[model samples]
Target chain A: MAGVRILVGTAKGGFILRGDERREHFTVEGPLFGGWEVFHLAASPVDPERLYASQAGGWFGQIVQRSDDGGRSWNPVDNAFVYDGEVGDHLFYDGTPQPWTFQKVWHLAPSLTDADVVYAGVEDAALFRSDDAGASWGELTGLRQHPSGTQWQPGAGGLCLHTIVQDPTDPGRLTVAISAAGVFVTEDGGASFDPANRGLQSGEIPSEQAEVGHCVHKLAQHPSRPQTLFMQKHWDVMRSDDGGGQWTEISGDLPTDFGFAIDVHAHEPETVYVVPILSDSEHYPPDGALRVYRSRTGGGEWEPLTRGLPQEHCYVNVLRDAMAVDTMDECGVYVGTTGGTVFASRDGGDNWEAVVDHLPRILSVEVQTLP
Target chain B: MIRVTLPAHLRTLARTGREVVVEAAGDPPTIRTVLDALEGAYPVLRGTIRDHTTRQRRAFVRFYACGEDLSQLPPDTPLPDEVVTGREPFAVVGAMAGG
Candidate 1:
């Protein structure tokens, strides 16, 4: 029990990898929901044994599976993500408003305090809550009904609410980021929300400072300093200091800022991690060199960490939700590549090694720190 | 009694024999009645074959009986006599891929 277990969700199934605190040796468990598309996998904060996954079938729609005993066994829970009241429409790719429809669950963020309560971010852009231990889901329609809803358009990945970050200091405070839509923050729980995309720019859009419609790929925040945030935009790396009130570009010195996946170090608040893709259209590393860039000065300056990683002839891309950090003293960093490899670093980001390689394409990766 | 054949995934989910017999409950045996009985008997299959709220067949699912595509027919439409009489299992199938 004094080690680390990683929860990995992939295109083919869900897998659990276990290792010692050093993270050198490991055991790979499963392809749990084989043949299903597992979009996101996460473990409940209070109870590491409790886990939840966002899975969907080609024909059966989305299903939420829960495991009370870590990843040993799984049971399909209430995956009925019915929107509150009559769901309206959001702007489509063509700019023609289309009816809002439930597509799939994109992300699941379990509550830090209550194992029974978890937040789900979904596609077609909405947030849902399941307080009954993933037995049922009810949409928090207030976020979707924001005045900026009409202006939100789909990114290449569709308009999906992919990032869910809860403030550690205030239990009621929550923040979510949607692709092509931007960021929204709720101070009084999910009853209401406000667009938090001030000082952001999108090259595709005509506005230099639009309130919404920014394609935020991934976002991560340190628990001790929740107000300060880091983001990997569709084209740039940005940081927000005032709880997303405003953001400034911090893509300095990286080969390219366009990438997915951003995470804060477990122990170092100023340290952050991101994998730089060549560009949105290319979806590969710069010059086929897979590097994990770390920003120790909180984003203005950066350095690349690549020891055991593929520095040559690697063209895999890390998805937005594929990177995670473990709360160990040395602080471990992990990222899942689209090519089906999970790379891990135990001594911060100085060096990395693959825990498990050659499975299905990875969609997300999460870690559990055990006592 | 009615005989029903489920798609592979649904069969695995329902945890039943490939061909199952349902009582059709207290109603005349129709496609809807048999489906309702199947769902009631296997709770795990709820919303798998049809929309949970609308009860419409999933876009990729189809119904066939007596070698005819009964998918376009309304849910309330009476299934063919062979299916209701258990002479043939009402085939619930995954629509052939790519039309």
Candidate 2:
């Protein structure tokens, strides 16, 4: 009775899709918190039943929702995300110094080992950890207080710490990516951090290889090969061999390298997937065709998997956190688009089918494999 | 008990009806005291109407009593006699915004 649960965060609410191991059929569950923008939804690897969601909107602000029964039921947890000490300032859009402010949580990373522990990546660029499930939170200020923090600028999406990758082998080591600020790595847990964007060149910035000004869109890492990382930058697809210490372009033959979502195959460490959009200005697929490019030999070699996808008149964009892979034997890959379609590829990326269509614009997609 | 009318969204969040009654601490219940009591009764509504740290009313949130806009008034300003006597319910409204 093994199953897979796909937790989808959308602009309006959250939905959970349940499918058996075959991955052919799925039952859709909710609009959990209607009228609220659900930024991200994640379940603890340690306890599949425990889940956390980042529910936020302009009118109601931010509220963390927790589900102990695996999205069957949920309750509101602590929403207070106060900074640790004096909130410093970062460069505003106009290059003027602006004070850091708490906006909303962008991503949630549950502990790899502890069900009660979770980390929240939030806008205004800061990290917060909650040890008592989602009942409380405390900022891990070292990332924001880095020496190069003053030079950090907001991307089009605002200054947000959107992606967080935790090393399964080393709990103390964590890597986080910020928009318009590049990447940061922490070795001593959250006590300290260092910029890890060496070889990441952004032509948009004054210095192409600057230490911490690149706008990284998303990052993906395989559990077995933690040292090797795949990234979808604002304009390029990249790979890092030494745990993000150095990176090299792998955008190779992509029609366009500007995309938001990137993910690695569940069983193949070298296999990665990315949806190439036209460009930064035109946030849609090339030639009105939606294709998910898969690279079996890591970055350089890739092929389009478009069996069941839209080949014409498609103009939807895939967000940074809208792609995920489930740990099934066949390796199921899922992608949610801004046009409200959730596509699933049961046999790697060769074939695809829409699990559910016409949902609100999807914000994030996460999968859980149940035993 | 001071009667307060909440916006649709806030009422749904607090799991209450359109109107709720709370006991404000001071003899003359001001906006601050009434909100403190409301938050104390329903902790989930803490940061919805105002900020968690600064306690400032959210930009789009407004307050009114006896058809007078009280959003610009100081937090400590006394409520009108109708509101204080429970004859009129102090209103917490979400201003018209977004398409």
Candidate 3:
């Protein structure tokens, strides 16, 4: 029987939730690496048993752990994230130059082809690649060394490169999103990058549609249609048809588009999902009612999926990496909240149920479908 | 042999108990030699106690020996006789940081 394994990263540690194909009941595994902030946990698409975790805290710095037998056991890998030659300055929030420094790893994107290869997105905003699994890492300096590097400023969460989207069809193409620096695409596999924020707009910056200043919260793409992308920016819900060459606002009929999470249905190319929060200043659901808006026709028309979800007195926020979809026959959608609840919809957002609750503040949720 | 007491987290990470022993290679055992031996014994603790590139002790990680704060001392400074001879254990402490 096929099953789904959900890897959840939380403020206190990491947890694994296992559910059979029916997707009804689940057993929670752990606070693996307890007392640490697990920013993200990712499993390799090529090998369901291979997994990587980004664990860090204030008292102790970053530690990358890799597991070969799924999440049963883990061993610490290399945590050294040294910048390549000549670390330069980037703009701080006050518009002053600050030297690039190494911080915790915010996101890890294992290779879609090779189980031994993985890429890490880290704060202080840089990309790193490990060929021998997670044993060692080297910075893909071209992205940071771009001409617009110095002008990029930190968002409220500090300057971090939190997203790395690999082009499923084209091995050489990859897309990465930073907090306040907008999106950048690499055609030569991390050797060089180009800004792809053509249609993105941000009212906070002096130029609303600058080349590289938009705060892109999260981006989602379906494997079948890699060129089409859906984004939940700091304020607007957006879609791009040309692999991020240009974007258009698809925030029509939504209450408030100020959200952090956006994801695509596993098997549907046009189906998309976004959780709408109140506003930029307020991070909770509108009217304390938790709702997930789904768009069957890509965007511009959306319907709220409220069945089995908390409709009132629910003030939790969904983070950018907290929503994921499993590629099962029925397509399971999972959402983890700041209130430490993992909500699941087994029947494609028609109905939902709490898979697990009261663990820790969830940071990221990723699911792997095992055959 | 030099005895070292690691913080609870470090002990957990190194997969050991509170105290571990290492053989310092310096002529007169110093903080640098002791740390080098510790990291050599447990590779996982390389970047945890100090910066990987700069080798500077982490901001919140302090060192103590013989009831004296040795965190501010230079890494190359020789250790006290009691610490070098294993009469007293060198301690690695995580500073009291508020959540």
Candidate 4:
């Protein structure tokens, strides 16, 4: 059958497991948009029946759901983002000087070839574009009017713009990852942007090579080598080859590189993936073991994918868009946990299974490979 | 008509059945003309109960009626005559602070 949907995004709703293509049986369906929070779930490489969700809540805000007969039905569209004129300011993790605020849609990048073109990564960090498929949305504003955006600061998950990386062979390049603001590059398609965070360092700021407060915690590339990027920084495990403009500290032997997702293996452009997490206030998994550190040769030789997961008590924690990969043909690796389990490995991670476990608390994991 | 109730997640995204009668004809009947007439007869409940360019109101939403708390009144105020007729329904609630 060669089908596979996966798409999950949780913390109350949105799930659709479905499976085939030897990834072995699965058929979960959904919490649909129930209770709200769906953070990100995109599918439209040129229209796989078109789908895009970022439904949110805290009492109904940020809604954008489009599915033209794919998720079986959905419409919502247009949740007004407004910001083009006076919405500029950032730096308040006590650095004071606040202002720009709109708080929700944490990620949803659609348009690798336009299913009506999309892209919205909000939460005060800014960047929105909806070429009319999700009804309407504007504001690209040279990425918060770049110029190092008043030294952007606010991570602890507030200043968001969470990972957008799309360079399917440069349709005017793109790479966005902001959380404490770091790594921004839009070679003239997103109107304007710079700070690719040259060789990021950030020893808690005050110029450790500052350009835009480094807190980038995820940025994988590989649509056939989009200039080779791959990061999982909030604490090293980076590598760039001139796309995010110079970075290199592949975090070699990795046991504690502190992480929040980083991926890049669809057919091995040197293969890569990360799930380190043990430091940065210990967010679980180094000794509580749930390993998944592959790297065929992309970032410093790694290897841990631990059989069907869980080694001794398995503490969980695997977020930052919650990892995903599936172009099928024997390469399938999907992960989503904060203890709501989703792990599946068709063959890439070497072996693992569990497509749907608890359900609410995943946040994101996309994949649509139907045929 | 104007009865409105929704909020079990917008009655499951307007698939309906948490009470809804709608038809907020304005002239003095406010709460943004009854949510612009319940999102103009459920146009996907427009930005989910207010906000699609600062029409404001969604901070864990709240809007009651004959029981007042009209979500802090003033979306042009004036609502009560049994929620402006249809004998008080106008709900929309869902607040319970963070986590």
Deviation from native of the Cα of residue A78 in model 3, angstroms: 0.9
lDDT score, candidate 4:
0.84
Q: Which stretches of candidate 2 lie over 4 Å from their true place?
A: none
Worst 10 residues of 1 chain A by lDDT: A79-88
- When candidate 2 is compared with the true two-chain complex, its DockQ is 0.78
Q: After superposition, how far is residue A134 of candidate 1 from its true place, in Å?
A: 1.0
Candidates' DockQ values?
0.58, 0.78, 0.74, 0.30
Pairs with backbone N, CA or C atoms under 3 Å apart (clashes), candidate 2 = none
Of the candidates numbered 1 and 4, which has the greater DockQ value? Answer: 1
Q: Which lDDT value does model 1 have at A272?
A: 88
True contacts kept of 2: 0.57
Ten residues in sequence with the least summed lDDT for candidate 4 chain A:
A146-155
For model 3 chain A, give the 10-residue run with minimal summed lDDT: A18-27
The reply for model 1, stretches above 4 Å from the true place, is B25-27
- A1-371, model 2: which lDDT tens digit per residue? 48899999999999999998788779999998988999999999999999999999898799999999999989999999998888889999999999998899999999998889999999999999999998999999899999899999999999999999999999989999999899999998888999999999999989987999999999999999989999999999999989999999999998899999999999999999999999999999999999999999899888999999999999999999999999988899999999999999989999999999999999999999899
DockQ, Cα level, model 1: 0.58
lDDT of 1 by residue, A57-155 (tens): 767777788999988888888767777877778899999988777788999999988889999999889999989899878889889988788778888
Predicted candidate 3 versus true structure: per-residue lDDT over B33-92, tens digit per residue: 999999999999988999898999999999999999999999999999999889999999
Docking class of 1: medium
Q: What is the lDDT of residue A279 in candidate 3?
A: 92
Ranking by DockQ: 2, 3, 1, 4
